[model samples]
Target: MEVSPIWSSIVTAAGGLLTGLAGTSGPLWHQRRALARARHAAEHDTTTGLPNRRALTAAVTRTVRRATPFGLVMLDLDGFKAINDTFGHEAGNDLLAEVGTRLAHLGPPVVMAARLSGDEFALLVAGGSDEIAAAAHAAWRAVSHPPVRLGEQAVPLRASVGHTTATLGISPRNLLHQADTAMYQAKQTGGGVHGATEPGPVTDPPPGTRRRDLRHPH
Candidate 1:
């Protein structure tokens, strides 16, 4: 996929600027939010029309600083490669676009949703443990319920979710990593949702599975 040079430049500049201003005071924080909103296009996925990885990181970082309680849910489709291999990449992409749309309208507690490359997506929400669990389950149902149609092909999609709740003093990277780890566990023990209550070693994706990229927006 040939990305627009304009899009690339905007993302680079905005992400670098935000990362550099990590510890700025008062007015600068407001400026950060303004910059993020103003340049939202730069940080959104062209295929899914959702925030990309960089946007999610910035939002999570800001929430951490405010000591806000939030939840992080990481989702990855199960057996996605088989679908692409059997049906085609176009069908896979269509299914993902539908999944993205469903994720975006989760409403209430879900404050942000983004595609984190490949078949992985993440959701950030304002909530406590119980609320976060409920929200994650709701999202899982949203993704897994309907059979996604790509032309004549009716594809049944299944996704695994890894979720965690954060308070204060936790870095955005740590929060994402913990959730990612739990997500791997979910995939390991038959796809469903897993909560990150205990830390463990990272698990590999299931055997015989090869990762591939499906999005190529020109």
Candidate 2:
């Protein structure tokens, strides 16, 4: 029997549609895979490639539940804002990236750095209070070593560190808060690093600004 022209046209259209879909399939699959990786990268630190705040918080919660002891260090770059203002943001970003690299080099129990935002960052060390302190000191030294080689004068940087530790006790959030307070105290006492559970108040006087009492601003 002879096929009608309408029937032949319908079959041809169906075949074309199927071929188009088949041609697009590979690209669609690739797009889906790329999106998944992007999502994972967003949840991690851009510089250190460590877990970002979201991931870190989840990990901290798990660590708390498991009663795993760890140390926390909240750090603030001393002259970061000024540095950025003077040189430019590119330089500033480079400095932060370098800091992240240094932290990654320290390894677990030694350092886990995350740029909380701008010149502010945090570190998680898997050890006791003493180890946390030592780590903080080492971090401070590393940061203050010399200016980064950004084709500019050596850009000297210093960090104020606050530290707290728990040997399978206390929530990670609370420990982080304690470290934050200590870091501020370091600022008040005039440059250098400080370690404590609670820092009195913001003591770091502004440049060319002096205070009589160690607690002068108080």
Candidate 3:
């Protein structure tokens, strides 16, 4: 009897289990499964389920090595501290998870999204200068939608977004730094979006400035 292609594939995948149930493939399968689980854990953020910082770096490095046209966007949530302070840390965590959901569905160009610690997030996309900016804007729009409900109150979401396009010689670190600087600029200019066209100083707002600015309802 000739084995069907489907059965053959299944047997091959199962390490010839059909040939012999007591074969020594259990150890190999266990090893492969363990390695896959470990890799997933290493690459994903525990809280938001987005890519972790190390994964982000590896992705950008691959893009740079391939000399691909890529875009990087850095986003920082506005009023995140106040939410934690008022509603508590649990609410803050919930908000971050929701934000991650929105970013992950940004569609097209955006190949990867990552939560880069705290209230900061990053996006890796493929596009030219204008297309990248559009993707960044779309991401910002998605995050800025709907109020994050906490108990009886509905708190409007807001974030500062900044983008940088990769050039032939630019390193991943430099690209991220540039996007971060532009995000800072956006926050300083009343929280919207900005893009880095050149290298320059990116200063943080005064300690109390964010609290004051974000205190009022949107």
Each model's lDDT: 0.83, 0.70, 0.85
Which 10-residue window in model 3 sums to the lowest lDDT?
208-217
Q: Model 1: which ten-residue window has the lowest total lDDT?
A: 209-218
lDDT of 3 at 100: 94
Error of 1 at 19 (Å): 41
Which order, best to worst by TM-score?
A: 3, 1, 2
Best by TM-score: 3
Residue range 63-101, candidate 3, lDDT tens digits: 999987998998999889888898889888999999998
Error of 1 at 150 (Å): 1.4
Task: Give the residue spans of candidate 2 off by over 4 A.
Answer: 1-32, 47-50, 167-169, 198-218
Please give, for residues 55-165, the per-residue lDDT of candidate 1 as tens digits: 999999989888878879988988887888887888778888899999999997999999998889999989798878888898899998888887876778898888999
On lDDT, the candidate that comes out on top is 3
> In model 1, what are the clashing residue pairs, if there are any?
none
lDDT of 2 by residue, 41-126 (tens): 97777755655767666666776786756777767777677888888888777888888777656665764567665566677777
TM-score of each model, in listed order: 0.74, 0.72, 0.80
